[model samples]
Every structure is written in structure tokens, then in C-alpha cells.
Target: MRVVTGIGAVAATVAATACLTFAHPAVAQDVKPDRAIKYRQSVLRAMDYNMDILEAMVKGETPPNKEVAAQSALFVEQLSHMPWSGFGPGTDQGAPTKARPEIWKDPEKFKSLQNDLMAATAKLAASAKSGDVAQWKGDFSAVADACRNCHRSFRAR
Candidate 1:
């Protein structure tokens, strides 16, 4: 009887796991416009937080820490890739996103801005790894400029 009970429990557990696994893909595919906007906003917020920390160190508001700088740069680089795909069709207008409709209308220009951001973040990451405060500062400024450029063009006032 114990053996039978154990087998039944295992079967139940396996069935429950399979149900969740199958349900997840369907749910993920049905991502709403608002959810996509929120996801991009979350990614941007995380990048902003990391940039604030790095900016404080660069500006002497905080003590310099190579590890923090390197980690922040790497984090920013990863985050830069998260928002673009979220700028899909329904996300441009329906959601609370500041993203301009031009992002979808002017695909080439938007793509250029995305490329610029990726390049700037990549440079910042490399500079951080160098452990040179001045290089990090310069690269951080470039990254900030790239962000501002995109915001000026794509974000609402």
C-alpha cells in the first residue's frame, strides 16, 4: 500500500509540473501591450539605478570602487538590450510608455539610435574593466549622452 501511495504521489507531481510547463508558454505568448511597456520601463529603471551609482562615484559624491563601476557597466550593457524588442506595435500608443510613435514609423532612425546605445554601453563596459577612473568617467559620459539622444527623439516630454 505504501508503494502504491508513493507512485500515485509521484504521478501527481509530474502531472502538475507538466501542466505548469505547458501553461507558461501560452501565457507568455499572450503578453499584453501594457505588460510590454512595463517590462521596458522596468529595464530602463534598473539601468538608471546603476548609472546613478556610477555617476555618484565619478562625481566624488561616493568613494571610488572599481568593482562597483565594473559591475554597473556590465549591468547597463545587458539592460540596453532589453527595451528595444518591447517597442513593438501595440506598445507605441496604448501603454503609458514615453516611446514616440516614430520608433515604429521611422524604423531606420530608431535602429541607428539602438546601435549607438549598444556601442556606447559596450565601450563603457570595456573602460570599466580597465580600472582607470578617467577612462570610466569618459565612457560613462558617452553612455549618458547616448541615452539622452534616444530620449530626446523617442521619449515624450
Candidate 2:
């Protein structure tokens, strides 16, 4: 328990030091476009924050905790289903965003990436439970690659 907690704290500290990404809640039906943007950012940022913990472990910057890793992966798996709602019509131009117009234009491609990410995270969540660092690391890479692939096509620099 302490180990899991300690890794989380250390992950937080490391995240604070690095150029970490930004967080937001669900948008109501009557929510403004900017609100949707905020909501999207929040979910992605939350994913990034949790991924940071797993990233640190994967990079060996901190010791890996299977429990902590599993927890983060599970959160990511759940989060993978979010943010798409925030990408509804008119959300392309609201607030500061890294999302690209391609996301709206080539939505099928974007949706495919979302599906890929969700699958990768699901696999990650399952693999993390076995506490096999090697398998965990490989699964982590698949998840990270899914993220990078999506960002390359759907998100701006």
C-alpha cells in the first residue's frame, strides 16, 4: 500500500517538474462550445496526469508498483470512453486546444484512434494486474503508441 502511494506521490512530483499537460468535468446539454473544450481538456489532462505515473514507472525514473500501475491503467481505460462527447458539433473552434480540424473533418479516422486507444488501455489494465513488469512495459508501450498515433493525426503541435 505504501509503495503504491509513494509511487503516486513521486509521480506527482515528477509531473510537477516536467512540462506536464493540463484537467475538466462533464459538459451539460446546454453547455457552450468552450465548455465542451474545457471538458475535453479536463479529461485528456486527467489521462495525461495518470499516464505520467505509469510513464515514470515505464521509464524507470521510479520503481514500478504493479498496484499503482494497474490503478492508473484502469483509470485510463475508463477515461478512454470520455472526451468524445466533448467533440460534438461546433467544438472545433472553442477555447485553447491541441485538437486538430482533422478530428472533425476525418472523424472516422479520429474515432478509429479512439477505439484503438481504448483497446490498448483495456489490454494495459488487464496486463498490469498480472504484475509482470516485462509484459506491463510492453503493454504500456502499446498504449503510449496508440496515444502518439492519435495525436500525430488528430492533435496539433
Candidate 3:
């Protein structure tokens, strides 16, 4: 009986120690800029394709198609994560970041840009659904302009 009790106590102690080791507060400091850079580059790639899609539609060099518009929408949605992820603690301030600190400082302005991006992209997607070449071109240009405008102010040159 004493041997069985000793075995049970040992098992309990091992389990408790294991749980404590695993449960220690994980230090999840901010994610490094390199990790976010990949995401940003992907967003930019999507934007580049979207721009090509718009230009092609506008020139009537290619068919005005829903796929182009859908792609634009997808990229715009994807872009939401880049700015915040790439800007802060994990990023080396001296590194080549196109992001300006004003984005974090001026929350209202930053949020406005985000809102405009979403709205413009949505409009482009809607126009694409209808396969309207003219509307697609207009919305595409507008969205691109918005992107440029934000980059001008918020992104580091």
C-alpha cells in the first residue's frame, strides 16, 4: 500500500511540473518586419496586377471581366494587415520602411485612408460584377489614386 501511494505522488509531481513548464507566459514580442514585409510585398503584387487589369480594361486591350475586378477586391482586402504589422516594434526604425510614423500618430487620418481603400475597392468589384468597362476604369483609377495619396503621406519615400 505504501509503495502504491509513493508511485501516485511521483506521478502527480511530474504532471504538475510538466504543466507549469508549458504554462509559463510566452513572450510573444511584436512580429519582426521581415515577416510582415512578405505580406506587404504580396499586397503590392496584388495591387500591381490590379493596376494592370484596370489599364487593360480601359484600353480595351483585353476583355472587361469579373475576374480582374475580383482580383482587385481580393488584394485590397489583403492589404488591411500590412501597415500595422510592418510599422511598429518589430521593425527596425532605420530599415527601409515606406511607412511613416504619422500613420500611427494620426489615427483618424490613417483610418480614413483605410476606409477609402475599402470603399473604392468595393466599388471596383461591383463594377466588375457588371463587366462595365468604363466604371471599372473609373473606380480602378480612383482606388489607385487613393493608394498613391496615402503612400505619399504615410509611406517613407
Among these predictions, the greatest lDDT belongs to 1
**Which digits, one per residue and each the tens of the lDDT, describe model 1 over residues 54-99?**
9999889999899999999999999998777667666775567678
- In order, what is each prediction's RMSD in angstroms? 5.5, 15.1, 7.7
lDDT of 3 by residue, 1-157 (tens): 3554687989989998987876632222344566655555566776667677667767888866677666665566456434444444544454456667787687688778877877877787777667776776787788888888788888777
Residues 1-157, candidate 2: write the lDDT tens digits: 3553677988978787663432233334457989889998999999999889999998889899978998998999899889888998788886998888888789899899999999999998999988888998898899899999998888889
**lDDT measured at residue 74 in model 1 versus the true structure, 0 to 100:** 98
Q: How far is candidate 1 from the true structure (C-alpha RMSD, Å)?
A: 5.5
Worst 10 residues of 1 by lDDT: 24-33
The TM-score that candidate 2 achieves is 0.79
List the candidates' TM-scores in order: 0.79, 0.79, 0.64
lDDT of 1 at 129: 82
Model 3 segments beyond 4 Å from truth?
1-29, 70-85, 88-95
How far out, in Å, is residue 74 in model 3? Answer: 4.5
Model 1 TM: 0.79
lDDT for predicted candidate 2 compared with the true structure: 0.86
Which candidate do you rate higher for lDDT, 1 or 3?
1
Sort order, TM-score high to low: 1, 2, 3
